[model samples]
Target: MEEQRPCLNKAEKGCEGPVEGRPSYAGTGTLIWRCTAHDNKAYEAAQETRTRYPDSSTPPGWFDPAAAGERWDDEY
Candidate 1:
Protein backbone atom coordinates (compact mmCIF):
# COMPACT_ATOMS: atom_id res chain seq x y z
CA MET A 1 0.00 0.00 0.00
CA GLU A 2 2.81 2.32 0.93
CA GLU A 3 4.28 1.71 -2.48
CA GLN A 4 1.02 2.85 -4.09
CA ARG A 5 1.17 6.19 -2.37
CA PRO A 6 2.84 9.35 -3.75
CA CYS A 7 0.35 8.99 -6.59
CA LEU A 8 -2.84 6.99 -6.58
CA ASN A 9 -5.03 7.50 -9.61
CA LYS A 10 -8.67 7.80 -8.67
CA ALA A 11 -10.55 4.64 -9.61
CA GLU A 12 -13.54 5.00 -11.87
CA LYS A 13 -16.94 4.90 -10.20
CA GLY A 14 -19.36 2.03 -10.90
CA CYS A 15 -16.47 -0.06 -12.15
CA GLU A 16 -18.30 -3.37 -11.98
CA GLY A 17 -16.98 -6.93 -12.01
CA PRO A 18 -14.30 -8.44 -9.80
CA VAL A 19 -13.81 -7.46 -6.18
CA GLU A 20 -12.21 -4.28 -7.49
CA GLY A 21 -11.55 -2.77 -10.89
CA ARG A 22 -8.22 -2.69 -12.66
CA PRO A 23 -6.09 0.43 -12.38
CA SER A 24 -3.34 1.36 -14.76
CA TYR A 25 0.17 1.70 -13.44
CA ALA A 26 2.48 4.64 -13.99
CA GLY A 27 5.27 4.33 -16.53
CA THR A 28 4.11 0.78 -17.19
CA GLY A 29 1.88 0.80 -20.24
CA THR A 30 1.64 -2.96 -20.56
CA LEU A 31 0.57 -3.76 -16.98
CA ILE A 32 -2.67 -2.84 -15.23
CA TRP A 33 -4.03 -2.97 -11.62
CA ARG A 34 -6.85 -4.87 -9.93
CA CYS A 35 -7.86 -3.54 -6.52
CA THR A 36 -9.25 -5.84 -3.79
CA ALA A 37 -9.39 -5.52 0.00
CA HIS A 38 -9.01 -8.64 2.09
CA ASP A 39 -10.76 -8.08 5.43
CA ASN A 40 -9.51 -4.49 5.54
CA LYS A 41 -6.03 -5.80 6.21
CA ALA A 42 -3.98 -3.30 4.26
CA TYR A 43 -0.73 -4.76 5.51
CA GLU A 44 -1.16 -8.40 6.44
CA ALA A 45 -3.45 -10.89 4.74
CA ALA A 46 -3.41 -14.57 3.97
CA GLN A 47 -4.93 -14.43 0.50
CA GLU A 48 -6.38 -11.77 -1.78
CA THR A 49 -8.00 -12.17 -5.15
CA ARG A 50 -7.50 -9.79 -8.09
CA THR A 51 -9.25 -9.15 -11.38
CA ARG A 52 -7.93 -7.27 -14.34
CA TYR A 53 -10.08 -4.49 -15.77
CA PRO A 54 -10.28 -4.36 -19.53
CA ASP A 55 -12.34 -2.43 -22.03
CA SER A 56 -15.95 -3.51 -22.28
CA SER A 57 -17.59 -4.73 -25.44
CA THR A 58 -18.98 -2.09 -27.77
CA PRO A 59 -21.10 -4.35 -29.99
CA PRO A 60 -20.89 -7.51 -32.06
CA GLY A 61 -17.39 -8.79 -32.87
CA TRP A 62 -15.94 -6.47 -30.26
CA PHE A 63 -13.18 -7.51 -27.91
CA ASP A 64 -14.54 -7.15 -24.43
CA PRO A 65 -12.03 -7.38 -21.69
CA ALA A 66 -14.85 -8.11 -19.29
CA ALA A 67 -15.91 -11.08 -21.35
CA ALA A 68 -12.33 -11.65 -22.37
CA GLY A 69 -13.58 -10.70 -25.84
CA GLU A 70 -15.94 -13.66 -26.25
CA ARG A 71 -18.49 -13.43 -29.04
CA TRP A 72 -22.09 -12.64 -28.13
CA ASP A 73 -23.96 -15.78 -29.07
CA ASP A 74 -27.16 -16.23 -27.10
CA GLU A 75 -27.90 -19.66 -28.55
CA TYR A 76 -26.47 -21.40 -25.50
Candidate 2:
Protein backbone atom coordinates (compact mmCIF):
# COMPACT_ATOMS: atom_id res chain seq x y z
CA MET A 1 0.00 0.00 0.00
CA GLU A 2 1.11 3.54 -0.59
CA GLU A 3 2.28 5.54 2.37
CA GLN A 4 -0.06 8.28 3.51
CA ARG A 5 0.80 11.78 4.52
CA PRO A 6 -0.02 13.12 7.96
CA CYS A 7 -1.77 16.38 8.64
CA LEU A 8 0.25 19.53 9.42
CA ASN A 9 -2.22 21.54 11.43
CA LYS A 10 0.01 21.67 14.49
CA ALA A 11 -1.44 24.56 16.37
CA GLU A 12 -2.44 24.02 20.00
CA LYS A 13 -3.96 20.81 18.55
CA GLY A 14 -2.89 18.37 15.85
CA CYS A 15 -4.74 16.67 13.00
CA GLU A 16 -4.81 13.64 10.63
CA GLY A 17 -4.81 14.80 7.07
CA PRO A 18 -2.47 16.01 4.37
CA VAL A 19 -1.50 19.66 4.03
CA GLU A 20 -3.64 20.40 0.97
CA GLY A 21 -1.81 23.62 0.24
CA ARG A 22 -1.41 27.22 1.24
CA PRO A 23 -4.08 29.45 -0.14
CA SER A 24 -5.28 32.91 0.58
CA TYR A 25 -8.12 33.08 3.04
CA ALA A 26 -11.25 34.22 1.37
CA GLY A 27 -11.58 38.02 1.36
CA THR A 28 -8.69 38.56 3.77
CA GLY A 29 -5.87 37.55 1.38
CA THR A 30 -4.14 35.89 4.31
CA LEU A 31 -2.20 32.78 3.38
CA ILE A 32 -3.54 29.63 5.01
CA TRP A 33 -3.53 25.92 4.48
CA ARG A 34 -6.53 24.04 3.16
CA CYS A 35 -6.63 21.21 5.65
CA THR A 36 -8.83 18.20 5.98
CA ALA A 37 -11.52 18.81 8.53
CA HIS A 38 -12.10 16.08 11.08
CA ASP A 39 -14.77 15.65 13.73
CA ASN A 40 -14.06 15.83 17.45
CA LYS A 41 -13.71 12.08 17.88
CA ALA A 42 -11.28 11.74 14.97
CA TYR A 43 -9.26 14.61 16.31
CA GLU A 44 -8.96 12.95 19.70
CA ALA A 45 -7.93 9.66 18.15
CA ALA A 46 -5.23 11.28 16.10
CA GLN A 47 -3.90 13.06 19.16
CA GLU A 48 -3.73 9.79 20.99
CA THR A 49 -1.88 8.10 18.15
CA ARG A 50 0.62 10.91 17.93
CA THR A 51 1.27 10.84 21.65
CA ARG A 52 1.57 7.09 21.82
CA TYR A 53 3.80 6.84 18.77
CA PRO A 54 6.06 9.79 19.20
CA ASP A 55 9.05 8.13 17.57
CA SER A 56 7.43 7.57 14.21
CA SER A 57 9.02 9.06 11.12
CA THR A 58 7.69 12.35 9.87
CA PRO A 59 4.67 12.11 7.59
CA PRO A 60 4.84 13.20 4.00
CA GLY A 61 2.53 16.13 4.55
CA TRP A 62 4.65 17.66 7.26
CA PHE A 63 6.19 20.98 6.36
CA ASP A 64 9.53 20.99 4.50
CA PRO A 65 11.89 23.83 3.68
CA ALA A 66 11.49 23.12 -0.03
CA ALA A 67 7.74 23.61 0.03
CA ALA A 68 7.49 26.39 2.55
CA GLY A 69 5.28 29.34 1.63
CA GLU A 70 4.24 27.56 -1.58
CA ARG A 71 0.65 27.72 -2.79
CA TRP A 72 -1.51 24.72 -3.53
CA ASP A 73 -3.38 25.44 -6.71
CA ASP A 74 -5.99 22.76 -6.21
CA GLU A 75 -7.54 21.53 -2.99
CA TYR A 76 -10.61 19.35 -2.73
Candidate 3:
Protein backbone atom coordinates (compact mmCIF):
# COMPACT_ATOMS: atom_id res chain seq x y z
CA MET A 1 0.00 0.00 0.00
CA GLU A 2 1.16 3.52 -0.73
CA GLU A 3 2.11 5.55 2.28
CA GLN A 4 -0.31 8.36 2.89
CA ARG A 5 1.07 11.88 2.93
CA PRO A 6 -0.29 14.11 5.64
CA CYS A 7 -1.81 17.33 4.51
CA LEU A 8 0.53 20.28 4.90
CA ASN A 9 -2.47 22.37 5.83
CA LYS A 10 -2.34 20.80 9.24
CA ALA A 11 0.54 23.08 10.04
CA GLU A 12 -1.59 26.09 9.26
CA LYS A 13 -5.05 25.16 10.38
CA GLY A 14 -5.10 21.78 12.15
CA CYS A 15 -6.61 19.91 9.21
CA GLU A 16 -6.39 16.15 9.74
CA GLY A 17 -7.12 15.02 6.18
CA PRO A 18 -4.48 13.16 4.21
CA VAL A 19 -3.33 14.34 0.83
CA GLU A 20 -5.72 13.06 -1.81
CA GLY A 21 -4.10 13.99 -5.13
CA ARG A 22 -1.08 15.49 -6.83
CA PRO A 23 0.74 18.14 -4.84
CA SER A 24 1.09 21.76 -5.81
CA TYR A 25 4.21 23.91 -6.01
CA ALA A 26 4.45 27.20 -4.28
CA GLY A 27 5.86 30.41 -5.73
CA THR A 28 9.11 29.66 -3.92
CA GLY A 29 9.11 26.16 -5.36
CA THR A 30 7.95 24.58 -2.13
CA LEU A 31 5.84 21.48 -2.49
CA ILE A 32 2.44 21.88 -0.89
CA TRP A 33 0.37 18.80 -0.11
CA ARG A 34 -3.09 19.59 1.05
CA CYS A 35 -6.43 17.83 1.39
CA THR A 36 -9.39 19.00 -0.72
CA ALA A 37 -10.79 21.16 2.05
CA HIS A 38 -7.58 23.01 2.79
CA ASP A 39 -6.62 23.19 -0.84
CA ASN A 40 -9.72 25.20 -1.69
CA LYS A 41 -9.18 27.46 1.28
CA ALA A 42 -5.58 28.13 0.37
CA TYR A 43 -6.48 28.83 -3.25
CA GLU A 44 -9.20 31.24 -2.32
CA ALA A 45 -7.01 33.03 0.20
CA ALA A 46 -4.21 33.35 -2.31
CA GLN A 47 -6.57 34.77 -4.90
CA GLU A 48 -7.92 37.33 -2.47
CA THR A 49 -4.43 38.35 -1.45
CA ARG A 50 -3.41 38.78 -5.07
CA THR A 51 -6.48 40.81 -5.90
CA ARG A 52 -5.97 43.09 -2.91
CA TYR A 53 -2.22 43.48 -3.28
CA PRO A 54 -1.34 43.11 -6.94
CA ASP A 55 1.96 44.91 -6.56
CA SER A 56 3.12 43.27 -3.37
CA SER A 57 6.69 42.08 -3.46
CA THR A 58 5.98 38.82 -1.73
CA PRO A 59 3.68 36.53 -3.63
CA PRO A 60 1.53 33.88 -1.97
CA GLY A 61 2.47 30.22 -2.15
CA TRP A 62 0.06 29.56 -5.00
CA PHE A 63 1.53 32.38 -7.06
CA ASP A 64 3.63 31.26 -10.02
CA PRO A 65 6.58 33.53 -10.62
CA ALA A 66 7.02 32.52 -14.23
CA ALA A 67 3.41 33.22 -15.04
CA ALA A 68 3.77 36.68 -13.54
CA GLY A 69 6.84 37.60 -15.60
CA GLU A 70 9.18 36.86 -12.69
CA ARG A 71 12.17 34.56 -12.90
CA TRP A 72 13.03 31.99 -10.24
CA ASP A 73 16.69 31.10 -10.02
CA ASP A 74 17.95 28.39 -7.74
CA GLU A 75 21.32 30.12 -7.45
CA TYR A 76 19.77 33.12 -5.78
Q: Give the TM-score of candidate 2.
A: 0.26
Q: Looking at model 3, report the run of 10 residues with the lowest lDDT sum.
A: 66-75
Order the candidate numbers by TM-score, best to worst: 3, 2, 1
TM-score of each: 0.19, 0.26, 0.53
The top-ranked prediction according to lDDT is: 3
**Decreasing lDDT order of the candidates:** 3, 2, 1
> Which model, 1 or 2, shows the larger lDDT?
2
* Candidate 3 positional error at 33, Å: 0.7
lDDT of each: 0.27, 0.41, 0.56
Candidate 3 lDDT, 1-76, residue by residue in tens = 9877777556565564557644332255555667777777766755676578766665456766433223333333
Question: What local lDDT does model 2 show for residue 43?
Answer: 37
Q: Which ranges in model 1 have alpha carbons more than 4 Å from their true place? A: 5-12, 15-30, 37-60, 64-76
Error of 2 at 58 (Å): 40
Q: How many residue pairs clash per model? A: 1, 0, 0
